[model samples]
Target: MSDRKRGSHRRVSTSPWKYVVATWFAGVLAAVGLGAVSPAGAALRSSLGLSTGELAWATSSITAVSAVLGIPAGWWIRRLGAHRALSWGLFVMSVATVAGATAGSWGMLLGSRIAEGVGYLLVFVAGPVVLTRVTRGGIRSAALALWGTCVPMGLAITAAAGGVLASRWTWNRWLALTALGPLIMAGVLTAVLPRLPRAPVQHPYRAVGAWKGALRLGAAYGSLSLVGVAVVMVLPLFLTERREVTPTAAGTLVALVCLGSAVGGLAASWLLRRGLALSSLVPLGALMPVACLPAFSAEFPLAVSGGAATLVLLVDGLLISAVFAAVPAAVSRAEDVDVANGILNQLGSVGMLMGPPVFGVAIAAAGWGAVAAATFVFGGLGTVLLLPGARTSGTGTAHGVARSLDAQDRVDVGEESEPLRKALDVSRPNRNRI
Candidate 1:
């Protein structure tokens, strides 16, 4: 290599992690954009003269795009390449949020939100696949696990920071403030993330059968989201009413619960590095909500109920993070990663949409106890759906995860293709500096 080329390689290799950090922050910013209107919703409704229905539409319009167009978004990201897709997604969100800030009518706000949703969809699907491409082995898995925390961390930022600030500012200022996150992230990403080459993907696409396990994992993710969102949506209200706490105190508690969830997610990185099978962790984490859901929802004492709620979030976070960390491994071809995430994002969007309504209906009809039953059914279903991945070594499809990070021997991809063992032939850190 020429001296110039070698020096360039050295610079790229020295801080490749910056790209990962910037890309991950873009995901968090996308989430912040989604939840921005939520904190200042009352101001928006009052200022724009929006009815409850209109406000609801404004909030959901973005997620609706995610529900309907996840696969398309995934393919879109694939075509654009992860770096371009991420940059564009962040750009879209920044623009849409600015438009939303100026929107005087419900229709205008709704339109902006829809645009934001498209951007949000792209970010969610592209994130995991981008991490897959950028990092190697342990770095890749760990980054993906941390990616699972984006939603909670973003929500936490909005709820803790956005919520407090909204009370002091007009809704337009709040919207303007929210717009800054994505805009800054977009700039950072462009500078930090060099144009890394994509792996050679087969044209006219062979290996169709190999990606089924990823798709199945996505399905299981949908099932898990159905129950997980329900619990998350209701927990604060549950605390407020059942424990006789103030709404602010309840929100604080909910934030603390999410912190616990983040801990669980971060722990997965450590566990995965140690060769723990991801398959075992998924169901084990899911099962806690089954028991804790009912316990919390029942007419238990405040301490018991609070403890159960905390347990549910922590364990479910572990489960969700495991699934995300397993996502790259779930596929055979490196090219399939985005599409698999798209399916997962799509189904997960559907579940997120249904959760609030489902929990509301259950609560109205059968009281608080219905969510427990719902958890039992959906959590069980999620477990069963994940079984295809679990057939190896009594562990789930995460067979490829925690494999030899030392690069001695790549786990044989063909040994078991059901949940997948991964073909670790993607770009390695040592192979090319950039």
Candidate 2:
């Protein structure tokens, strides 16, 4: 038992933050590689004279298909460990990306995107799981923020780099670079990642029972990421379409959100050290909607409005990063770290999958301003939902007290189930004394 405890402690290290960074950057590379290989699908479609439906399918498959791959990827990582799985996944992904860059037909490009989807799921799922298993507290929060910010940050960098290279070089040059990032990432990850000692699979995923809570978390994450998606996708259009800003300038403005997000990551890591409750993130989450208000009411000069938007956007970015940082801790406070992490990630995946569509429909029915308002409404509702349950005696305490009560209740959650163990142990703060 003592040996097992030592092994478990070893599994959950305070070091190995580098491995966390590498694995997450690998996820970022996957996102960048996919984007680089097929950045201008609409233009490519018009050049090919493809139908609207075909173009939509091609454009949507990148993330939608990737989202569906998360479940199996999670299970696979538990069995194979992160290194071997990520190495092979990244290799295959790189190959597919290069293939897409070379494709002469839309069908081939679509196939490559679909293949990349598989690789994306494998890498993204494994990276976070590895981070949680390997770190605790501030390091863990920092690691997660690093991983979370990388997607937007990578996309911004890749998109800009692709545009700059495309002015003089072919698109394939940028795609090649993007593809190369993952291959290099795989090697770096393998070298730096500590060997994950094999352990018996003890915990299994359970269905989330708290729909009220799940919906709140989902809506909050989804709304924020949705606005982010809309901004990333449509900001350039907004600048060029409505404001007559130069494409380069517009692109720069759009990319600033990602820069803000990266900065926000550092803020979140700092917040963790301040000993803030995870639920406090709800207010930050609420700020996302408020941030959008300025974009609508820009009565000042372009520079002024843009700068104002950017500053508000910094807070928006901070909120998004903070929430992502906080949710895992919230789950840790509420349940088992691994199990709650899995469920939270699964819900995040679901939210991410759902976000784009919600924004798309709102964009069609109303407009960008309306979509922003919708984002605000969703976020507000989410904040309200995260408020601690009023009658909740079984929530928000340390792991041991919940365990005792669960044992008394005869739930028989079993020793192997880490989530059950954790959930039972974390007692409600309301009733927990000493």
lDDT of 2 by residue, 1-434 (tens): 66556445544442354556577778778767646643554455655566766666655566665455554455556667655667777887888878876866779777887887777766765666556545544455556656666666677676677667755665556556678888887788766665543323555554455334433444455555655665556556666876778977877776665566666655665665465554554466556666665554435566765664564445545555554454443432222332333333455556555666676677678876764677676656545544442112123432232343234323433554343233222321223222
The lDDT of model 2 is 0.57
**What does the lDDT read for residue 187 in candidate 1?**
85
Residue 100 CA displacement from its true place in model 2, Å = 1.1
TM-score of each model, paired residue for residue: 0.84, 0.76
> Quick one: best TM-score, which candidate?
1
Residues 74-168, candidate 1, lDDT per residue (tens digit)?
77776777777888888899999999999988888999999999889888988887677656655666777778777766776777887689999
Q: What ranges in model 1 sit over 4 Å off? A: 1-16, 198-211, 290-303, 390-434
Which residue pairs in model 2 clash with each other?
395-428, 397-427, 398-425, 398-426, 399-425, 399-426, 402-424, 403-424
Give residue 62's lDDT in candidate 2 (0 to 100): 61
C-alpha lDDT score of every prediction, in listed order: 0.71, 0.57
